[model samples]
Target chain A: MALSAVRAPKIQLRQVRKVFDAHEQGMVALQNVDLDVSANEFVTLVGASGCGKSTLLRIIGGLEYATRGDVLIDGHGVLGPGSDRAMVFQHYSLYPWLRVMENIKFSRRLQANRGELTSSEVEAASGRADALLNVMGLSNAADKYPNQLSGGMQQRVAIARALLPRPQVLLMDEPFGALDAQTREVMHDLILHVFKLERATIVFVTHDVEEAIYLGQRVVLMAPRPGRIDTIYRVPLPAQRHQDMKHAPEFLALKREILQRIRETSGMKTDLELLEKLSHSVSISSLRTQG
Target chain B: MHNFSFSRPARRPAWFAVRGQIGRREYWMLALVGLVVPLLLWWSLSASGLVTKVFMPGPADVWNRAVLWFREDDLLGDIGISVYRVVAAWGLSALIAIPLGLAIGTYRPVQALLEPLTDFIRYMPAVAFIPLVMLWIGITEGSKIAIIWIGTFFQMVLMVAEDVRRVPMAQIETAQTMGARRSEIVSLVLLPAAKPAILDTLRVTMGWAWTYLVVAELVAANSGLGYAILRAQRFLQTDKIFAGIIIIGLIGLLLDQLFRALHRKAFPWLYLR
Candidate 1:
């Protein structure tokens, strides 16, 4: 009985490395990443551009392969994309030809094809889809095409589509990046509310420090060019959060900590000076060897 | 944020309500110019006696001959035969070309294998293929349809294949992530996404079908519009020849309009270029 007492993490990544051959440049995207996401926990990855947070999320989603390590979902080796994991892309990649209801029901139909569910089971799934549409405040626009909706409404539909499969892990790569600031804030709140309601484990990647602090249970900061975990902060906040909490002491402290870590890892100071020197210099190849 | 302002509604003019319902002003002006300038020039040339009336008949003479042909002979039958050839050849071309194009488009090895042959056939003038078609299926309706098919099929194949191939990789990946099988991806995602492009190619290829019809009927026994023109040419009836030419232009324009209407009905999503 004791041997059967163990519970696996929803997602686990160990010693993962990813490399790309960008023609002449040998690009190292991620190196030796070790992470564990508990069931129903919300985690966020934050860094500047090129820090490979999105790449890491893709590896977890089984959309990309790691050159050197292991990615396991519920104790099984992640090989290809599965219904157990769903991703929300930044570009709102809903099929233009399909209406909002059909987009939401797509994954469910695929799951039905795998013999995981019967016709009656699919009918139940459709009911749940209707409920999700209501939760996302898109019940009125269920018959509209993606192009007919606003950017915020489109993203809401994208979220609904991702949640339809009822995946154990929801991987979002800056899902609100295209929305305006006011809409982004609203979407962030909506997402947190949905997470609490569904109790689904989420791995969200973003470059905004405040957003990471606002939405993450644990914020993981990554360094660039061979991206690795720079720091992890456990956010102390109530389960139900509001805009007022963002002005609280705890929120500001976490924001400052994340911003400082990002500054340290960004290489901005040295890069700026080098860029300034390059702009002024006519020929820098000879000057490089002496330096 | 800026404050919102409110204004009183202005009284509408009667002409303002009817503005969009009427034909565009520029189109009417162009039509007037088109009619007057051509007629005036024709009358001036005829009165001036620059060219003889036997070789280049006036528009009035052509119109009179068109009326006579309609009244005396079965001109409608000729129109019907030409329409049949166009529809049959185009329908057959769609059946053969769309699937073949999809196959070549989706599979890299197939594309590579077929690309050389595709390019060769696409560039080789369709008129050049008429002699071989005549030799193979000589002077029959089969040969005429074959010529039209040969002319349109290659262009359809290239256009449809390129359209299918150009489907966004992101869309495919999205489908894959949803656990769609290979066939499901092709049918549900690839086919629907390529529908607009395929319809566009079909519209363009319809015009090519009409062009091939003229060449196909040139060698034939005696039926379609092309044969009527050929019969007129034998007697040197300049008015009859002009009438046939006008009918061909009008039919081509009508077919183009029909395709335009179908395009609007089928794919209202695609913005017209």
Candidate 2:
């Protein structure tokens, strides 16, 4: 059995503190947050809104700069937005102007443009893009623009684009948050399939505890009010996850326990308020759909 | 968690339905109504003789004058001259405006330095510049072209800047995350992303170019449609004045339609939703 527990840490965050300057005072988005993720490990950060889970993910992705402390990738100080880390936002951040195949190709070309490729390399890259599209079940819609795609399809293309350069770390902020229940189920299976296919470290942030436990080998529970990790739970599920496993008594037991822990970690009033604010920030349709 | 519904019921009236999309048939019918209603009003007023022909020429009188202008006089020559001047001046304005607007929009320091000045200048009507332009350029074709350019350039700059600002921040960040250099981001992401709206800005400002043409040819010109209108006004050739007005409207409509068609062809994906 290949276990990630014994592996060396691929990503190390040392006392990361982020304080956003408000008008008169500062808001602490993360307070001395420290986390270490091993290579090929799938870690999911679960919490109610405003727990700074997304902020933590963004810091790791280099989309944001932390006010204090260091983020190190492979024992090196993190630089801003390199090709080594790729992100999939909750909002389908696919380029609206580019077609699916072109979007994947463009992001890949930008990252991997170490001078012109030989014709064979170009052929291989095209083959990989096509294979990714097939895995995402978007082969038929390759020529369509992002605007023409459904929400699930758009997110799939976004994930494909993020995967094009074969990034070492994949940061996803609720990648399937906007999808319907059926689509989300399919996406979960698709994501699990992709996880099995590749051996990259993934950090996923979501509000759903069940999803966190389902997708991750280790689930990190976060709490708001100066956001910090409350606890990290090692999943006891089988090495290979299945849809049927969600209904298993062990899975349900873990899901219920995590739900109770999350509920108590952040009190109801703040959680409800955060949910309201988040719903208003994004479309209500995304929040209304149960995932 | 199950206590409340996510969506609230709309309080819209039963008769007032809202929808984002309209069918092609309905669109054409609405367009037909737009043209037909105005023509109906003109036909009714003219046929009823509510106003005298001298004061308000009927469609027939205007039509007769139009035929005479195109067939007998140097009307086509005047039309050609006005078109050429507008195309030249407007083209020159775009040449300067697009790049300058891009720089102003992309960098806040550039905007801070120039936006206030442009904001002040654009408010001053292009018509107010006629005397000064005539003084500087001495009533040459340069003076006429200067009229359209001055009237359009500043306003276009502000509009292009605004459209540039409206480019999605998410798109830019995405491009950056994809390892695009700053210059590459500007060229591949920002410029192409801002294109459709900039084209729209150009379309809107070109209409202003037409309005300023009358003021442009005010600089002692003996040839444009504006000059013809002025000459007709002096002789009290009311029909010729009306005919010139009709010509301006027709030409403006033609130019607007051509721009719209070209825009559609260029950015088909932009119109999907």
Candidate 3:
């Protein structure tokens, strides 16, 4: 299969830029971003809100287009959404009206309609869905609606739905940002397990730096105000890293280093400093008037 | 481990927990108050003889007429006819509205083309169309069904379209990323996400369909409950008219109850609140 041997970077984004005309505000979501993910690489983009981490992931997923630059999936110029990629959204965007099993079967039916597979092949895909449900520990809730499941379980279903098509690249946008602390930990473990099992190149976007450190092979930290990558750190830990690794001295040092870089580029002091200077000038003006 | 013993006597069930009772005590009490207050006022008016029975019939007279209608099966037949019309009209409307609604909802071009026409039709009263429909389809079952369908179809389209549009953008994006075609997106994401809303619209439009029955039967038709009421009105038979009104009220109540039951059965999680 020469198609399999082409050795394409599973996804590549070259000098991507995104601009949003939101409520009369000219917001540059991403700027001059160049990134690539190899096959089975676990990449994470983490930043403050409006940093365009999610925008960049959406571009790679073909959900949104960049104003400049190009997105390529396996050497093909990304046009629109393609089956080579699958995305899981933050709010557990499972169809509430469908049972878990039906939701999983949806992508398979789509594949069948595309003439990519026969009826029996589609049935095998459905069988894979059953197997995925079992793997995700949602076999009992297979018949239940999205509303009936807890936040964690719903996200599990969302992940399962994304994996149903066996996409080469998985794009996730803060998929666990809604869960509580304990559930988030469990979901992190579950995601790591599935990522290993599926061997799909994944680009996960989140605001949680600790989550990026724990999950990503490379943590790409982004900065806002014309969003661009601030730093990209290749995690030196072994592939089978655990939660306890977060407590290690080396891990803490890396975390502190990344945190320092984030704070430097954060531009957090501009607004407050401007306000203080303005207040001082205003007081001086009042004093001069009194004098 | 320490063991503590503090046992209390078993308590009786709360008011709502009782089973196999015809009605709750509060319901009976409310019913009593309702009956007695109205009866006392009516009896007082009747006893004063401020109005004669010939002109203003007493409650007893109306009750007797109701009993007579019930005994003669006229009330039941009227109720049956009204139910038949509402169900048939709504069924036909659903058959036409849902597919068309889905189409218009899924395709922007179709939606833009049909939106103004739908908006114009929605504001036009079903009753206002009675004369025109009578002329076009004549005073027959066809005209009545057509009027009811017209009354319901516009509202159904609007509701289903709104539901379809309300399908989350993220879901559609997710499906598209997984390589779903436009038609597949409609079936898998748009339709399923819009299911509860569409069902709710169908249920609501059932009531609207019933509301059109009187106008639909305004022609030379002779059998429906609406026609029966019209005949009663022409002859000044107020008692039969009142009976017909009561039958309509009861049937509407039953239809609403049926809708609620169906909603709960189909969408049990939606009723968790």
Candidate 1 on B168-249: residue-level lDDT in tens? 7767767767778888788888898888788878888988888888777876648888778888889998888888888988
Residue runs of model 2 more than 4 Å from their true location after superposition? A1-7, A111-116, A269-291, B1-17, B20-26, B271-273
Candidate 2, pairs of clashing residues: none
What TM value does chain B of candidate 3 have? Answer: 0.78
Candidate 1 error regions (>4 Å): A1-6, A21-27, A111-119, A227-230, A236-239, A248-266, A270-291, B1-57, B230-241, B267-273
Location of the lowest summed lDDT over 10 successive residues in candidate 1 chain A: A1-10
lDDT of each: 0.84, 0.86, 0.83
In candidate 1, which residue pairs get closer than 3 Å at backbone N, Cα or C atoms, i.e. clash?
A: none
Total backbone clashes of model 2? Answer: 0
Q: Kindly report the docking quality category of candidate 3.
A: acceptable
User: Model 3: how far is B80 from its true place, Å?
Assistant: 4.5
Q: DockQ (Cα-based) per candidate?
A: 0.32, 0.47, 0.47
lDDT of 2: 0.86
* Model 1, CA-based lDDT: 0.84
List fnat, each candidate: 0.39, 0.47, 0.74
Ranking by lDDT: 2, 1, 3
Displacement of the residue B104 alpha carbon in candidate 3, Å: 2.9
